[model samples]
Target: MCAAYGEERASRTRINPAVLILGFKIHRSLRMQQSNKPEEQSASILRSR
Candidate 1:
């Protein structure tokens, strides 16, 4: 029973970091998109002028 519990924990631990990394990547990309929009708008405005 202890071994099974340990195996379950190990599997969970293995999966957790991948989940965290994916979440972090998605968060970073979302932030990048948010941060980039104003710069893009300004660039377009300059081009229009």
Candidate 2:
């Protein structure tokens, strides 16, 4: 039971980072088109997330 639970947790953790990274990249691209200051926008985006 513990091993099964660990596997489930690991799978979830792995998917979460990939999703976050993909979302961040998409958001950055969209924000880049909308604004010139990406550093500030990305910092705000990270804080908001």
Candidate 3:
């Protein structure tokens, strides 16, 4: 959705391609971080052993 939104915004507005790409990258990282929380929790528990 964010990728599509960036495409639409780029086509409709005059935003820089670099900015759009950066925003998309940040959004992707945030999504990945959200998904990784459970894995991080498990890793932390193992590390405490």
Error of 2 at 46 (Å): 25
Candidate 3 deviant stretches above 4 angstroms: 1-14, 37-49
lDDT of candidate 1 at residue 5, scale 0 to 100: 58
TM-score of each: 0.42, 0.39, 0.43
Tens-digit per-residue lDDT, 1-49, candidate 2: 5444545665677567776566567667776776758888897899999
Superior by lDDT: candidate 2 or candidate 3: 3
Clashing pairs in 1: none
Please list the C-alpha lDDT of all candidates, in the order they appear: 0.66, 0.66, 0.77
Candidate 1 residues 1-49, lDDT tens each? 5444545665677667776576567667766666668887798789999
TM-score quality measure for candidate 2: 0.39
Model 1 lDDT at residue 49: 100
Ten-residue segment with the worst summed lDDT in candidate 3?
A: 1-10
Q: How many backbone clashes does candidate 2 have?
A: 0
Cα shift from native, residue 11, model 2 (Å):
17
> Candidate 3's residue-wise lDDT over 1-49, tens digit each?
7667767767887888788788778788877777668888798789999
Report how far off residue 7 is in candidate 3 (Å).
Answer: 13
The candidate scoring highest on TM-score is 3
Q: Could you arrange the candidates by TM-score from highest to lowest? A: 3, 1, 2
